[model samples]
Target: MKRVVITSVGAVTPVGLDAESMWQNVKQGKHGFAPISSFDTSRLKVKNAAEIRNWDPVAMGLNKKEARRMDRYTQFAMAAAKQLIDSAGDLSGIDPYRAGVIVGSGIGGFQSTVTEHAKFLEKGPDRVSVFLIPMMICNMAAGQIAIEYKFRGDNFAPVTACATSAHAIGEAFRKIKDGYLDLCITGGSEGSINEFAVAGFQNMGALTESQDCDRLCIPFDKERSGFVMSEGAGLLLLEEYEHAKARGAQILGEIVGYGATDDAHHITGPDPEGDGAAHAMLHAIREAGIEPGEVGYINAHGTSTPLNEQCETAAIKRAFGEHAYKLAVSSTKSVTGHMLGAAGGVEAIITMKALEEGVLPPTVGYKVPDELCDLDYVTEGARKTEIKYALSNSLGFGGHNASLLLKKFEG
Candidate 1:
């Protein structure tokens, strides 16, 4: 099989609008949790989230008129895609037909749905805009990216709830490995941090109700209540190893293995036994042809929720056994909050960066470790550790579990 590697990364996360900025803030153990400013949370129990403050598309070189047509999710995707393309450099030589885009979103244009429905109910039929359907669709991010970059190859979005982007990245890896495409823009973008989304997760008991920003998203902590809702986008430029080498592209990391499984347990909750998650991790490690001890770091699916942290810890133990205690595992969600669908994308970038820079980001805000989640979660700030192979895990709603193994790029 042909090799696949990550060439560039882009992100519009709560911590920063770009991957480098986000990584710096994340390494410093800064948490982005704050009071929700996009909408009034006076009527809701959950008043805070990891929101991207002061995002202006026009300032990012987007035309004002064109920006108005796209939903916030699409805008975020466009911004990140631009950054990825720019960072990748001179894709003009690569055939548009040989390129692809696969950006996923769990709930696309949720704000559009909420606002448009209210307009329809208030003003009968003709008031709804024609762009409503295009804007609100979950696949529009990928579609719009293809339109923007003229990538005529495979273009689609894999909506697997929170595991959406991880699936996208894994599928892109398969395509590139099979010589299906030379260049692929893959990741996830989400903009569901609106009144409807917050209210829904709040009522479903998925979000943290605490108003204190410092203690909001304490993943794996015994006092952790729930995940803090957030919205953002993360995009990666994936290229075939030969293609990237021939073009002199700076390879960031090699995606050695990808594993996906279904829990078949619950729609909203992960399996307590972590059978599916463990299988995913094991499959990824086995596919990479590495012993469990070889994995030096893991970006866990620690959502700051009791069940998720406990289940993921169990999964890690099952997959890594004794080596699990030796490896450094941390959840960047402790710093960036729960970014829903975009979580895997950002976390994947973090894993690759850790392998590249020999610095492991800490799981910020972890005060007391839960007895059920007793693992070497790197909580003592950022640690200097050389990581050869790292795993980024994402377990989403609807039993979707995905894991991607990234190896340090030597060349």
Candidate 2:
């Protein structure tokens, strides 16, 4: 199998608009959760969310016409893709057909769909825009990215709910490792912070109802009620290790293993025994050719919902045994406020940065830890430590479980 490594990264989240800024804010334990500003939330009980503010697509080099046809999620994906390609330097030597995109979103163009549906009700079917289908589909995030960069290989979106981007990235790694592709753009993006989305989550009892910014999404904490709804995008440039080395590209990190599984227990809830989640982590660790003790950190899928945190804790312990207690485990969602489909992609960036910079990002807003989730959570801000291997976990709706293992790039 060919070795695959991350060459560059791009991020657009509530914490920061770019990769460097996002890393800085993450290390500082800065919180991104606040009230939703994109739409009115006067009627909904869930008001606060981690929203990207003051973002200008045109300022980010997006053309006016293209922006109009795209939904906010695609816009975010394109913005992140441009950032990744630019940071990767000149890729002129690589064949565009060998390089492809695999970005995913749990809900695509949700806001656009909601608004257009309202027009259809008010002014009949003729009032609906012809671009509605292209704008609202879940796969357009990947499609638009491919169209923009002229990438013609293995382009598609993996819609596994919250595991959406994690699966996209994991599959991309497999393609490169198995000699199927030379390079790929992979990650997850989301833009569902609208009234209808919020109302649906609120009605389903899935969103955190807290109005306070600091207490919104307290992952693994005793007071954690549910996940905070948020929106953003994360994109990564992945290349064959030999190709990256030959081009003199700076390697960010190496994705050594990927594991995906399904709970088959519930649609929105994980298996109470955490069997599938544990297996996902164990599979990733085994594929990385490393012992459980060799893993030093984990970016947990701690959604702050009671079920997710408790089950993830059990799954970690089940997978790593004593090493789980020793590892510097933390949830970036505690500060980033659960970017839904984009969670895995953004968390991957945070985990890679932790391995690269030798620091552990904290699970902020955690004061009283739940006994069920007792682990070495890095709650006291950033901790400087050498991390040879780090794992990022993402458990999504419909029992989807995905884990990715990354090793520090030494060569």
Candidate 3:
């Protein structure tokens, strides 16, 4: 089997526009939550979201015509992809057929769907734009990225709700490890912060009602309410170890193991026993050929929701035994809000950064902890620590669970 290594990473996040900038912001324990400005929220109970402020597609290098035809999520993906490609110097050596793209979005073109549907109701079906269908599908982000970069090998988008991007990255690792491809671009994007999307989530009781930015999205805190909707993109470039080493590529980290499982328990709630999530973690650790104690940090799927935090804590204890207490665990969602499908990709980047830099990001806003979540939550601030292995977990709405184990690149 071939080894898979991350060559470059890029992000379009609420806290920052690029991966390095986001890492710096996270290290300082900064958050991006604010009142919803994308639309009037007077009619809704949820009033705030982590929006990517001052976003200008043209400034990100997309022409007006291209931006108009594509959905906002796709635009975010393209921008992140551009950043990844730019940082990955001299990729022209790899064959196009040996390259691939896998980008996923939980809710793709939601604003487009709402806008065109409103137009159809107001005027007529003919009033709708011609690009509606192509723009609204969840797979267009991957399709557009493939077209942009001309990658021809095994390209597809995974749609596992919040676990979407983790699955994307994990599958990409498999493609390279199994010798199906030499290089791949993988991640997730989301742009569904409009009023309609907010309304749907709020009505479902999945959005935080806290009007205060400081109080909102407090993962693992007893005062936690629900997740705040956020929009952004996170992408990474992965290449075979030999392929990257031959080109003198700057390796960021190595993806050593991945595990995916389904709860089969509920539509929107995790299994109360956390059996599925525990197995996923164990599978990942087992695949990495390392003991649970070797994993020093975990970027939890701590969505700030009561059920998610409690269940994930239980899962961790079940998987790691006594070592669960020895490891540092945090949820960057407390900083970035819930990016939904993009959460996995973004958190993966953060984990890789933490492993490379010897820092563990804190779960900001964590106060009044619950007894159920008794592990070290890293609430005070970012901790300086050297860790060999880091695991990132992403659990989606539909009982989807994915864990990616990354090792600090020693070579």
Q: Tell me the lDDT of candidate 2.
A: 0.91
| Winning model by lDDT | 3
TM-scores of the candidates are: 0.99, 0.99, 0.99
Across residues 81-131, which tens digit of lDDT does each residue of candidate 1 receive? 888888896677898888999889998999789889999999977999889
- Any idea what lDDT model 3 has? 0.93
Q: Which residue runs does candidate 2 get wrong by more than 4 Å?
A: none
* Candidate 3 lDDT, 1-411, residue by residue in tens: 999999999899999999999999988989999998888989999989999988898999877898999998999999999999999988878899999998899988897999999999999989999999999999999999899889998889999999999999999999999999999999999999988888888888888899889989898898898999998999999999999999889999999999999999999999988989999999989988999999999999999898999999999999999999999999999899899899999999999999999999999988797989999989989999999999999999889999999999998
Give the CA lDDT, 0 to 100, for residue 262 in model 2. Answer: 98
Query: Per-residue CA lDDT of candidate 2, range 27-131, in tens?
Result: 998888877888788898988988889878998878889999999998999899989988897788888878989999999899899999999999999999999
Worst 10 contiguous positions by lDDT, candidate 2: 33-42
Clashing residue pair totals per candidate (backbone < 3 A) = 0, 0, 0
User: Which scores greater on lDDT, model 2 or model 3?
Assistant: 3
